[model samples]
Target: MVQNLSTLQLLLIVGGGIAYTVGIPVLVKRRPDPWPKTFGYHEIWHVITVVAATMHFTAVSDVLA
Candidate 1:
């Protein structure tokens, strides 16, 4: 499916991306540490989503292009 991006869509993407990135680290239980020092698969995915969202927003902001 071809999807067109909107301001709300971008905002949601950014919010979701940040939530995932921060949530995983905060939610995961680690011994001697509240946050995960070495993130697992889910955290890795979160990082990827955050990076993708950042790039997406940057692209969207360049409205003249």
Candidate 2:
């Protein structure tokens, strides 16, 4: 079925892409407090990135013919 991209979905795809992209360097070079090295900051950030990418893909795909 053909579908169109909605505003929220578009925003999510764009925002999630930006966050997923920007979050990496920030999480790597300069991690926030309360999430020490032992807490797997990079790993957790990667998981978040995967989730965001998945969301972006799912939303974009839904709008395709």
TM-score versus the correct structure, for each prediction = 0.40, 0.59
Candidate 1 structure quality by residue, lDDT tens digits, 1-65: 11666666566566656655665554364223324567654566565566666656665565325
Q: Name the regions of candidate 2 deviating beyond 4 angstroms.
A: 1-4, 33-38
- The residue pairs found clashing in candidate 2 are none
| TM-score attained by model 2 | 0.59
Model 1 lDDT at residue 8: 60
What tens digits encode model 2's per-residue C-alpha lDDT throughout 1-65?
12456776787788788878877775877555345656566766877788888888777776763
When summed lDDT is taken over every stretch of 10 residues in candidate 1, the lowest stretch is 26-35
Alpha-carbon RMSD of each model:
7.5, 4.0
